[model samples]
Target: MSRIGKKPVPLPAGVTATISGQSIEVKGPKGTLSFKATDDVTLTQEEGAVAVQPRGTSKRARQQWGMSRSMVENLVTGVTQGFKKELDITGVGYRATMQGNVLKLALGYSHDVNYEPPAGVKITTPSARNDVIVVEGIDPQQVGQVAAEIREWRGPEPYKGKGIRYRGEFIFRKEGKKK
Candidate 1:
């Protein structure tokens, strides 16, 4: 039995879900989201909760069962509370700023880097120094992907720990070379 699949996904107040064939749609205050599950899994709603079960005992079916349930749960949470990711910029000349929809970044390079987030995702610099950035979206995956893309511009190096990194991320320091 799949433990994650067995747990029912409870619908919070003001959230609604609908099942059509293999696809499920969730609507809440934030927005509406939908997911299509594989044929190996069965999705059903009962008593204001959603449930997923394997159509057969095969390994593929069991795998889809848990995955489907998680997708549904993520939709519910997304429409209700949404998701967010934070990034921290570190270095002597590293900085970030937002001009309209464009994100301007300076990371010790000869030229500044400008980034535009995809649809449905919002990026903002909350501090005047433009060192901290916040990415917000209804989909957790999109929010995380955007944050990763921004961090990729200047990954943290062990020496001096200069670069862009996710909040709370740790960079191991290295010793300086002997003179």
Candidate 2:
């Protein structure tokens, strides 16, 4: 049996969940989200909770059942409380600003980089140096993807440890050679 799949997902207040066909949809105060169920997994939305069942005893089916259930649970929680990703900018002259849902970043490069926040994703700056960028959304997948894309704009350098980085992330600094 799959431990994760065996657990029932609790529905938060003000959130509604529905299972239709092969997809599950969740609507909450934040927004609406949906996920497709795998072939080997079955979803049943009961009274105030969601349950997952594996179709067969096969290894793959059992594995997918747990994953699908966890995914569904995440969707429900995301729509209710939302998710966030924080990144810090390092290096002189590196900064970020929000202009009408667009994030413009200066990363000590020749040109400036701009990122347009997707629907339901909010970006905010808490400091003048643009060292802090907070990305918020109801969908964890989307929020994480956006943060990753932004980080890719200017990855951290091993020599100087400069660039955009996630909060609590540790970057191993490489030492310079002495000739």
Candidate 3:
């Protein structure tokens, strides 16, 4: 038996959840999210809570049951409170600014990089901090995907660390050779 899989996920008020065959959809106060259930897993809802169960007591079923339940849980939370990812610019001259829906990145390059924020994702630069970027959205995967794409524009360099990186992320520096 999977402990996490057996645990019930509480549904909040004004949230609607539906299970049809191998698909589960959760509509919450923030938004709606859906995911496909695993082959060896089944989901049951009762008393405003959802639980996952495996079809058999096999190793694979047990493992997949927990994973499926976690995915469902993430969907619920994503539609409710939503998700956000923060990135920081590390170089001295590197800075980010928003021109309408496009993000202009000046990363010491000859030409500036422009990234258009996708629909449903919000990018905010609250403070004057040169390195701060906040991205928020109801879909966890979309938020993360956009953040990753933005970071890829100028990934942190191992030498001068002149690039975009997630907030609080540690960068490992290599020591120079002895003379």
Q: Of models 2 and 3, which has the larger TM-score?
A: 2
| Pairs that collide, model 1 | none
Give each model a TM-score: 0.96, 0.95, 0.93
Ranking by TM-score: 1, 2, 3
lDDT sort, best first:
1, 2, 3
- What would the per-residue lDDT of candidate 2 be over residues 30-57, giving only the tens digit for each residue? 8889999888988898889989898889
- lDDT for each candidate structure: 0.94, 0.90, 0.87
The top-ranked prediction according to lDDT is: 1
Question: Which prediction has more favorable lDDT, 1 or 2?
Answer: 1
Which residue runs does candidate 1 get wrong by more than 4 Å? none
lDDT of 3 by residue, 6-63 (tens): 8888888888789998899999888788999878998888899888889998899999
RMSD in order of candidates? 1.0, 1.1, 1.5
In terms of lDDT, model 3 sits at 0.87
Worst 10 residues of 2 by lDDT: 125-134
Per model, state how many residue pairs clash: 0, 0, 0
